[model samples]
Target: MEESDIVKDIEKKTRLTSLKKYMWGPNILNLTLIIMVSQQQFLGRLSLLSTVLLLISIALNGITLIFFSKEIRYEENQQGIHKPFNKLTIRLLIFIIIFFGAITIGYFIR
Candidate 1:
């Protein structure tokens, strides 16, 4: 392969790695929020601070997903793959939306 092709390969790998790293934060936060919200009796209550954090987490996850999706599309186009709808993308979006909706309901009810 040409040097240019090698450099592009490295760039693509780096971009994918960075995308995964960007996802890690929100994924961990989502898991933590799920656990905390599930334990109502153990925790006994939710605070305003927690509610705010939940909202922030949702927004962060969404922003990261948007960026990741764009990068994926760009990379796929570069690779000559025309798939626009990835199952994993759809699944993650649905999961986050449901999680956000549930948290919003909890925030209001609490």
Candidate 2:
């Protein structure tokens, strides 16, 4: 490969790395929420602050998914692949939705 090609490849990898770093914020938030939910007493309810945190976490997760999906689509397009739904992406989406639903239900039932 030419020097220019090597430079371009390095730049692309750096961009992807930066994007992945952006994703970690939401991933950590989701994990924290999961831990908190698990520790709650069976009969206890989410407080208003916890509900708000859940909402923020869900929104952050959604945004991360959107950024990741766009990156996957771009890569697929560049490689001439036609995968419409990546399994990991689908799992993340489902998990976020389930978490959001659980929190919403908990808020209402409190």
Question: What lDDT tens digits, residue by residue, belong to model 2 across residues 23-90?
Answer: 67767777667545544556466777876776677667767767776885675566466867676677
TM-score per candidate, chains pooled: 0.64, 0.59
Error of 2 at 78 (Å): 3.4
TM-score of 2: 0.59
Error at 49, model 1, angstroms: 3.7
- Candidate lDDT scores, in order, read 0.69, 0.67
TM-score: model 1 vs. ground truth:
0.64
Q: Stretches of candidate 2 above 4 Å error?
A: 1-3, 37-39, 42-46, 79-85, 104-110
Clashes of 1: 0
lDDT of 1 by residue, 1-110 (tens): 45698888888777766776776776677667665664544666777787667667766776766776677667666767676667557857786776766676666556
**Stretches of candidate 1 exceeding 4 Å from the true structure:** 1-3, 104-109
Compute the lDDT of residue 88 as modeled in candidate 1: 59
